[model samples]
Target: MPSRRAVLAGISTGALTSLTGCVSTKRTGATPGTDSNTDWPMFGADRMRSGYAPSAAAPRSSPTERFTASLEGTPIGQPIIADGTVLQSTWYGIEAFDAVSGELLWRFRDEEPGDTAVQYQPPAVHDGVAYVGTESGLVALDVESGDEQWRIETASRVSAPPVAGYDWHHLYIGTIEGELLEVSLEDRASSSPGTVRWKRSVYGEIVRLVAPNIAGVTAGTTGGEVYMVYDGRGLWRTKVPGGVTAMTAEQGNSLYVATFGGGVLKLRTAAHAGRVSWHTEVGPVAQGLLVRAAGAVYGADGGGLTKLGTDGGRERWTFAEAASTIPAAAGDTLYIGGTDSILAYKLSGGTGVAGARIDPQRWQYTHDGGYASGVSIADGAVFAAVGDEPRLLAVE
Candidate 1:
């Protein structure tokens, strides 16, 4: 047995409504301590909604060099890496820079329009297309050309980043008011019913990319409802039980739900017609969720951390505020940004991943006054957004 030591490693809202739009993207790198270019896709990469990024970046014990910082506003949205370019959405707009050099690449900007309030989710980009979710509306732009691709809007605001499915045929986004609008990517790019894939309602507003379906795109509602439309032909709705803020992981087999109120549920998508298989209560006030390679489900809350078995319902382990930030897993290692330090854990069952001196030189980063946003792991580096500065830290 392990003593919570042994292996060492590292690292919502609606404003009232506008506050929820500025989501923080936290994930672990896949390949141990190397921040690779590929791997992380969508909020949690997998359908189960686990908030883990499997990159090959080395776990940076400390940041190589801190950057120019985002004075625009705090970076609540996660940073995305595509084709060697890193794109992050701040309260201001979408800013792209070189992943390795930190060179300013390009920026798509916007103003709050009025005291209306602002919420922005990290943009999703691929090939050369970048899709952004802003306080006012959504915009489609060419990643390389920097030319406008298409545009869509809603009376309300958009803070959750856009998730793409249907091979760019359709774009799904959630709003600060809880509206799930479907837009088209056709030559015209209109969200008309013909082009509209589908839409749903969440008694609460949609926060981030913790989407409903596994294709890792079509999002569910904030009211704990999973919206599904078979092949975009018919509509089906199912309610989980609580409001969702973060997506855990999107595995190939099941859909995992991490609720803001509490608990992490594993639902198996039917071989033919999928429905809820079973659900087990893990804990309360679960603000975060994660799944290990061992298939063990984990989550974080105000009290501490808790673990659940993959079998649907079972309690595993819980770590205190000392280990609160959403946990990220890649291979057998787990990384966490805790109240005291950036901790690492080994999932071999012995003790668990913890007990390392990240920034042992000085415990400058604290989770009380501010949150340690989610982690983005690659090769051997960790990217984190912290404080009011909207700073993206690189630890390797």
Candidate 2:
């Protein structure tokens, strides 16, 4: 395939603004339909931040490049596949593309001409609106046309991706100032788009958040403090051993938290209190979103992916040389994005001996670019954003 580097020129600020400023840039005008079971709509595939996509028929053998598109900024968050479109969040804004053809559909950048604030969080698509975090606020854009529907400024910078329940009625997020925001999505269809339902003080730098259901939201702070807020009230609060780096929910009541202190803790989200289920040491410093799939929890830290059993948090096997991005698992295969390649590995089903090292390489798709992070799979297709040069690659 020929390089698409020549198409790197960004749309002029004025032109881009017009596209997002209530003007249609190829609006389908069709009401966004419900996403399929295989759609990787948001970060970690769902509001729980679980990076598993069990229904997606991911590639089993060596994957082939379908298409590639150059981007305008360094990609930060993971690629989101929803409603036949792939959305990637970069340092500047979000870029949407045709999931199959890799065509640039529409780009949304809310930054002013000289603003230096960066948008590091990924976007979440619910119903038909895409919720993206800007430097100081959250903006909702029409998924069909890139039209700006509404925006609400936060108390501080959004620290993680905005998440929503299945109904999309309430949006939840954390902030650098230790605030957990619950934004109402009920008014999104009205003339005025959004409303800040409430902002509760978490008392520490809130870094990660997960909304397992509409009534409850779990937030993790930089100080290792975790809180379970239900129905706009703090239901429970607890602390792990280290700074919380990421979190994932299993079966709605169980949460797996990866910490920077070299451990992954399983916590029970009960109505009365947050109880530690199990704490398993992974690497020297465990980080990244915990992935729950095939009856195991996967944590990444220090260039390795560790698989642990869900029953007792026992270490199963470690896949060394894992990349920076979270791995996507479906069925028996794990797809990882490396610096310049996307690799597939055959999962051992956690039946192997504990702490065993394994690397059953299945396939690899290479690109002559920078970091190939944000590996997302949906409907048998894999998508990744190559950072530095900023390019999106589609494979199947």
> Residue 128, candidate 2: how far off, in angstroms?
1.9
Task: Report the C-alpha displacement of residue 339, candidate 1, in angstroms.
Answer: 3.4
Query: Per-residue lDDT of 203-237 in model 2, one digit per residue for the tens?
Result: 68777888886577889888888998876689889
Span of ten consecutive residues with least summed lDDT in model 1: 354-363
Q: lDDT of each model, Cα atoms only?
A: 0.54, 0.74
TM-score of 2: 0.85
Q: TM-score of model 1 relative to the true fold?
A: 0.73
Q: Work out the TM-score per prediction.
A: 0.73, 0.85
Estimate candidate 1's RMSD in Å: 10.3
Best prediction by lDDT? 2
The prediction achieving the highest TM-score against the true structure is 2
Q: Give the runs in model 2 whose Cα sits over 4 Å from its true position.
A: 1-37, 187-193, 283-286, 349-352, 355-359
